[model samples]
Target: MDLKEQYEKLLRYCYMLTKDVNLAEDIVQETYLRFWQSHTYKDTNKELAYLYTIARNLCMDEFRKPKLDDIEDYCELSGESEYEPEARIDSLVIEEALEQIPKDLRELIVLRFTNEMSVTDIAKIVGISRFAVHRRLKEGLMLLRRNIGGEAND
Candidate 1:
């Protein structure tokens, strides 16, 4: 993908991580800036993973800051007219279900399904083993299914 497309995807991923639009944008910009400023930009093959690592680290830094407010307060309802009501409802339902799961599992679920990231890429981003990524993904999906009242496979 081109830089513009990659930027958009990174923005979405950061949004998923931070649950705040402005913070996500700031983190994404800093991620790109840091990527360009650092020598790690030479590796073309692992660009996305590197970008994710930077964004995730920036987000973790933000989370470490002293803040008594809840991140969920930044959540906003979409007013876009393009999506059908059922689709929006389903999205909201799934998002709500996602909120009920553990944060680590939710991150894996979002990375795998929401952002369409590969397990290997996710492993690299999260600094975990590929087998662990797969295992956690399965556990996450099962929990999501249970939360959404769907028929979960054993």
Candidate 2:
């Protein structure tokens, strides 16, 4: 697949991790730079994985730096009035619930649901077994349900 296809997804992933749109853009830029600079794109099939791995690493590095409270928050919610009120409310609730879960779980859930990655791909990126990814995803869903005050795994 084309690397551009993964661009927005990687940016969104980094933004969620860093909570700063400008920093997310910078991180994604570094991701692309490193990918190009390292010649890792020679194998086209693994390019997406490589790009994601690079982005994930950069996001982790972002966590190591001194944080500034002046950074602006990047909320993904759309302000379009065309969206149904109930749907908007539900989205807000789910987003808030997602924020409450552990970062690892939230990332897994986002990788699966938002990025549409398979368990194997997630395992490769996370350096974990498929079983662990499944377990974390299941546990994340349970926690999200509880946070939203719904039945478990509902």
lDDT of 2 by residue, 1-154 (tens): 4667677778778877876667777999898888888765665346666678888999898777786544432134222224333337667777789999999999999899988888988998888999999999999999998988852345
CA-lDDT, candidates in order: 0.79, 0.78
How many clashing pairs does model 1 include? 0
- Which residues of candidate 1, in runs, are more than 4 Å off? 39-46, 69-87, 150-154
**Model 1 per-residue lDDT tens digits across residues 25-125:** 88988888888886555553356787789899999998899865654443443222233334476688888888899999999998888778888889999
Provide the lowest-lDDT 10-residue window in model 2: 72-81
Residue 79 lDDT, candidate 2, scale 0-100: 24
For model 1, name the residue pairs that clash: none
Per-candidate TM-score against the hidden true structure: 0.79, 0.76
TM-score of 2: 0.76
